[model samples]
Target chain A: MDKNMVTNARELTNTEFFYGHKACAGCGGSLAVRLALKVLGQNSFVSLPPNCMSAVGFLFPQISFVTNAIIAPFAANAAVLSGIEAGAKALGLKDHHVVGFAGDGGTADIGIQALSGAIDRGDRIIYICYDNEAYMNTGIQQSGLTPYGARTTTSPAGKNLPGSIKMKKNMFEIVAAHGISYAATASIGYPEDYLKKVSKAAQCESTSYIHVMAPCCTGWGFPGERTIEIAKEAVDCGLWFLAEYENEKFTLNRKPSSFSPVKEYLMKQGRFRHLGDDDISIIERHRDHKWEKMLKNWDS
Target chain B: MDRPKVVKYKEPERAEDYPVGATFKAGHLVQTNSGWRTFRPIIDQDKCIKCLRCFLVCPDGAIDKSGESLEIDYDFCKGCGVCAHECKVGAIRMVKEGADEDGR
Candidate 1:
């Protein structure tokens, strides 16, 4: 069982990420930052790259972080985090969590080399990718992590093709390949779970990675209000999977008794709205197969 | 839009007063812009059960829960109506940001 931040009775958490930062209305990435910081707290430091998070939240003088945060290049967050960890050790600093919070593009594509190198070098860092599916801050261009059949500015739907036919790069599994201490998939809708994951990851003897599914209102073409709603729907419909790899063991969390159909999740977003019944069914098939593979990995 | 206040850094003792960016824009960020929002959610205390549902689902962290009843900080709220939408009991409603009396 996971430890709860639950004090006494009410499920409230003191946060290190504050408002007044320039995140869009109902931004899931913003919430992810808040929850992650809620666990990591004032002792934590964030090394952000040139993603939406760095662009808006920490807009120079008008910053929003309640903890120490620094900006790194798109491909160098992991490298920077490695240095921070080394420096902390050299100075004999304890309980300081150096986090590399990047977007999907930064993690799965541009920054993969540094991330793999850091993992291989056994850096004690908490690396989190708050994935909103595409390069949102740069105007919604589809990246390697964008799911199949979702439309982006680069992968606009046309008569020939529905949208992006590329399957999202499996970042969670790939990070696990390096044989790190911990890695997991989490979503903004599941705040306590994400918070608990961060809390646990902070105590890891080695690198910890969390790939958070953050819904983008503007990019996904959903109402700003539905950011949390669609996030929950993503998990409820099995489009997004939550599980962890800790102590060299795979454990899945919160499986629905009956997954609401893939359509129930897809139809909510305009990007996936272009998807037809055929596309949804095909996606559903993939989802089921992915869940099966995850179960197999867990039982192994 | 007004820029954030930049605080001058002093020695170790005063350094604690200034955080990461050393900007004093903490709580004053909500309604600083002229064209920030078109709608805002108003809580109906009569129907509220204090479930903290609205408080939890607020993406911007705009809802203030310090008081006995839940209140919204107009400055931080972007009038997203997410709180209104997420209220399971329909205890919140989205009011037009400017249609009625000038929303402070």
Candidate 2:
């Protein structure tokens, strides 16, 4: 009933999302889908938009899911999931978990309207945005979610200009502003913590939104094997922070004893390789400033 | 000039499929396969602590428990090595696809 909450051991039962599809060998978004489905289980129905995940994870003659799933429009993932939740209720269904699983581009940029509407209307769904920095599915295009100083095909670093001049959009705060029952920032590196949060969201009455940092090896120009490693490093260096909001309360899940240098995090990805000392200092200051702001908002 | 003949056939007399309107099937499997992997994961029973982390972390969802052991479905595993990479006990090893008889 409660997805058989695993206590001391990881359950041996199979998950809803399985292999067979055409995700890249080192794809992080696919990995995130697998973990999310593991917690949501077969009773959940996920909405995949026109992201890298929809392209590789689900397509024509071949599909990867073992449970129920639907492919939605790029900007209509949240909209479609809202309808599914409404329909599920109308059918006198019980225990149906409708989830909108979209990419950074879909969630923060294209699909924000439907996402915001669904959250505002208080739909019972868990909207998770697996952010891989850029629109990686379409040949590394720059999206609003792409972090500053990162290179995308649309915002390539050239002679005079550095990569993305604008900083990343803060969507978690935006979701929290909606007075959502559950909103959090999670990373692929923290599976236990991430799973716990998703499960908690499942039990909540209001909509839940989790923005997860999913490192992309191909888009980030790193070896596929370093996907989780980079995700962990991002949080360790304060490049990304893990925190949650419930009932208007805030708590930081991770606050490193001593923050790792931002250079270690930036240097690992080719997207930020062209950054010089001045750019690095700017990024370092940005991270510290963001962390200070989060500290102030902590416990609010 | 030979033109194909349009023969009247039985209209496939079955409930052709509509997701919602009034006809909808509750559940079905969507597991298509592409296991073109050169290497596959093999969990050694001796070393496994039954932590189930491999099954939990496999991107392909190819790992399953067999009795007190775990197994990987090479037919669907894409050789991502994520299971092996995440295994803390080193119980899972990625072996060459055809190395079963080579005794490596």
Candidate 3:
């Protein structure tokens, strides 16, 4: 809902895009979608697929979307958005925006092919992948988007295998490789940067891919309000980086002042409740690898 | 991999400026139809006891007191429905959409 703390303009404003729906007390996905829609405004059409979003927003007359939202299948968010963009043109509609909001399970895993296709086609639509690690919607199962060594229903904590075995997919690089006009990574913690990137993408005439690292309080077993705090922790720990690529040039938007220890961040969440020194060390090594890569890119 | 054909850019001609309307030129396509949703909260005045819970809890300055009636901007409402939730008397309900169907 218009979370723009600075604005008081009131004229048919929708504060909550998808309200009256069921979500945990502190649902980062809900907040991320709402904030992204606010930035896009009334002229935008959101294409959501089957996930927590679709389930929460598109359940019959109980729709939470306050504007011109269209429900697509779980995997068709990108393609549907492309069609909406085309339809917008054919109908002489200007000042309209299209957004494909998908979960990381949908974007980094099941729906990646369609997303890649839309970017490859250079369709002028904005796509935001709300990365909450595991697929919290479908029983908190592990998906390709889940980070390494993070507990999930599928990847239960054990002596040998604490959580997920593989690291999270490098989605920003993958989308950037498509040579799209705009690609960015953001987190809920950085509102200005996130809003700025969304505004920038809206003004562009080519496809823009935005990956937002949204923390899941229910999935992570943290307090509802702590969603934002966890989001900040992820960024502070260097486990998450906010950056954008314009014309293939990488720009690091927010770099960590001093890297925060990953253990403390993990300890606060229930999903990481099983983590010990070995798992902590593994997570640290992974974070260092990502940080070094980002540093190298920034320097280059 | 086949390198998809990239269309060449051409300068858009300035059409006779109108107050507000859609225009198109050769090789230019306008995005007309947006499939996204915008949410607004409507109050059941009968149920509304002027509790003003919505006005105080609104994160986006979309809510205001209009005389005895509470005024909410459907256009600017992100549809978060915090106002509806905060209403003590079950006064506010989130409406399906803002504006009309014609894209006015």
Candidate 4:
């Protein structure tokens, strides 16, 4: 581990590696990309799929990444990252990192196969999934990572059915299960922790993954400025968590002594505005069940 | 394949003036996003603690902290108010765009 890791906002690089893109106001995905790029420095090669980051980043005649970056196919973000790593190695490049920033839909749903393949091959690359909980760029569609009670365009809240019945996929654990060199769950709300994870991923010799929960203001139905606040609340309320996997071990980071009210967290979002008490309880129950298993199996 | 060049933004007089491929220079500020902003964040230097919280939280990378005091680049800032919202010391305030300098 780097002794002088950047643990504070003051220690972050002053350079703006990501800028002038057309991301929506307070877009959490863009913040994740910007912060990660700052940590990776100018030598990094970024691969983004057809997610919000790419849509708003790679606009014609206005590329956002200062470093070498490309738009990979929807399901090929990790694959492109592997190729970039191989090319960099072939060219004898040093002090460079190949990284991919995919959205939740791209990671947990579409790009899982290629990501798994990259891990299986032990490719030296960093895969970051900035999960805003759905296919936010494509008009708020239901995705594999969408929470059970969140409403979306496809999963409409009606008189009978709750929004989405499927819980968010355990992407961090899924990647860790492949025996990855490093894997962590983060949130844009916790910038220091997220920055440290990116720095760690850059230092890893083999496949590394970080799944960051980024709140989508437009899609999630919250004030744009409240994105970071809501993201923090999610972790504090036990809906999202911060953890890391390494050396065949799982470590829980920042375990809350007692979770804040999950209803308060969910009610702030427009997508959950229609969620009834029963739905909230179901979500809370699921969270408690997951935490019980995590506390028993992981090191806190 | 040619080495990518830093092509500056210019109005194309003819179709031939366009770049050869679907490519652009990295990190080029091709366009300013000030038009999208409805409100702008003004930093109160007296109250600012230099915590760099606003700089780190600005999604657009519009906050400039290279100087002695933080500055917001109005050209690219979308006026989302995240900086003002995140500032813990009550150093930043969101003012309506096009308002008087005194925040009338």
Candidate 5:
């Protein structure tokens, strides 16, 4: 680890790389981008897709990013990062980092192919997916990363259905399958852990990807003040896990002895309020299955 | 490529006056966002532990920690109350926007 690693909040830079945007109050995605940019520093070349961060940060006549940044197309965030990396290298730029901030819809649904190609080509870029679980910028619509039983504008809860019937795509494992240089799963609730991952990604010589679970207060139907609390509860309840893949091995950073009740976490969010006991059981069963596989194969 | 000139925003009278590609300087505070806030966070300096948790968690970067005492930049704070909610010692309180003597 480098001496510049931010192990605590006080060590973080006072210089705000992201600020003065129109993001909703207590927006987790914006916070994630802000904190990651702090870790990456001012020399970072940031590429954001047409997600909440870009929509809110790149307002015309009032741009937010202090570092050099541009808005990439929704499906070309990774490709743009790759281009930035190659262009910087050609220009003989030193001590510069090429990073991308894409949302779940941009990463898992639209930008996944471009991301895969970048990793396959061994491009030296950092791709951070601030997964808010759905397409929050364009209203609350379900995406491929939306969890099962969560109510979205498109996937409503009613007598016949229990919201989204599909589970979130395993983005971390999928990225790791490419034998990328570095990959990690993070959450805004655990800022320190997420910061460490961002730092590690910046240090990678080749492509690196970090999938961070950022909770959205407006989309999730929760009080703005409760964003951090709800994000922590999600991980504590076993819905999200912190892990990293390096050197062709997976390591779990946190292994809770026992998980908190899933119902308490679900009932707090408006999206999951309509879920029944059967739906809750199904979610728990899936969580247990995932844990069983991870505990058996992954190193803790 | 050379760094683009930082042009101040102005009402465009003609198309030729606009900056190339409509580029704006990064991190330029275009306008104050205080109007968006319904509540304001007031920090009790005596009770604050200076943990810097609130500083790191602020989405708007409204909390200023560079001075001897932490200051809340009301111009940009949207008053989400996350800092007050995350305060371990209840040092930060969210007051309704117009309830105070300042009437703001």
Candidate 6:
């Protein structure tokens, strides 16, 4: 549904958040951090868990950060951000924005408890989950966020339950249920909507949670160039919706009048290559059910 | 000692502009037209057991081995540490530009 919304590489913020650091070609995690940090500027402190990000930047005194950065334990990002927020307020420096960036593994599974506590307690901070659909930091292992029928190291396609059997946990809805001020699903495919949600989250008075779908080129087994394309097609096919929830009201940002088949989105990545006719039918049924439910809220 | 086998990027039958025996040093970094470039992930042959884990795990096909020693082509290697993580024998070490974590 996103039409002509991608940003040219030139218009992006030139900050060196991950400069001189190592990431795979077309690494969406890298781009997500770069752009997200650009919106949440130098005054922000990043509480990163032990994910791909910790390995992407330089270590210790030779760090690659232009802003204050802290590495929390694998699942303790939210707790650390809570502490930072409390500490900053105690020091009369509450203006400091504490941004908690966690991968899908950390967010949906390991760090979910802490994230829920922070939001429920009304900690003034923004939490961003750069979901790549698997535990890529730990050699492509399956996580709670892995989509059904996607291949991961633990969920390899084979005789029984060919790929990941369980559908991805509906994290946006889960976060919304906590009564946060803002909750949204975003994708790197739609830069303007992505940036707009990020910018709005930055200014919100209460806790904000933004879950972004960042395409992983190496783990997804796709060419580096298709990163943006695949992300765009996801929204087009309605597999991933770009919508926001504020104060119990759901607003579908880009509601498609008519969406393409989910197969168009799935077939682009090798992770979904093993899906058969029945699997595709099941996915369509699931997608239609979810989309219809979401549409009901915005329909009248 | 294998003397860290030297390789020259030459055409099949023509002499390339690159100098022979120039030796890609361990810590040297160059600023190309696009951006500043640097050396990363130096391999210690003594520790290398030729397990081929580095080759198999390289995100980019930047690693090329001749069955005996592994060579890293920095042109395509973005320096992500999938190889170093997969290297169980502790043969590959990520040596940043002008830093001494080698013996650490």
What DockQ do the predictions score, one after another? 0.28, 0.20, 0.03, 0.51, 0.49, 0.03
Tens-place lDDT per residue, model 6, A6-110, is 233233343334343356665777667767776677788888898887676544223444577778888788999989988888889855678988999899999
Where is model 6 more than 4 Å wrong at Cα? A1-12, B1-104
Where does candidate 6 chain B have its weakest 10-residue lDDT segment? B27-36
TM-score of each: 0.88, 0.87, 0.73, 0.96, 0.96, 0.72
What does the lDDT read for residue A157 in candidate 2? 96
Off by over 4 Å in 5: B1-8, B101-104
What's the residue-level lDDT of A113 in candidate 5?
95
Choose 2 or 3, whichever is better by TM-score: 2
Across A32-138, the per-residue lDDT of candidate 5 in tens digits comes to 99999989998999999899999988777788889999988889999999999999999999999999999999999999999999999999999999999999999
True contacts kept of 2: 0.31
Stretches of candidate 3 off by over 4 Å are A1-15, B1-104
Error of 3 at A124 (Å): 0.8
A89 Cα displacement, candidate 1 (Å): 2.1
**RMSD to true structure for each model, in Å:** 4.9, 7.0, 13.6, 3.1, 3.1, 15.4
The Cα local distance difference test for each model comes to 0.79, 0.77, 0.72, 0.90, 0.90, 0.73
Worst 10 residues of 5 chain A by lDDT: A1-10
Answer with 1 or 5, whichever has the higher lDDT.
Answer: 5
Docking quality of model 6: it rates as incorrect
lDDT, candidate 3, A234-276, per-residue tens: 8998889888888778889877668888889989999888888
Per-residue lDDT over A57-166 for candidate 4, one digit per residue giving the tens place of the 0 to 100 score: 78777887888889999999999999999999999999998999999999999999999999999999999999999999989999999999889999998988899988
Residue ranges of candidate 2 with Cα displaced over 4 Å: A1-12, B1-35, B97-104
Comparing 2 and 6 by TM-score, which wins? 2
Instruction: Judging by lDDT, tell me the better candidate of 3 and 4.
Output: 4
Candidate 1: the clashing residue pairs are: B30-B75, B30-B76, B31-B75
TM-score of 3: 0.73
**Clash number for model 1?**
3
Q: Which ten contiguous residues of candidate 3 chain A have the minimum total lDDT?
A: A4-13
Candidate 1: give its CA RMSD in angstroms: 4.9
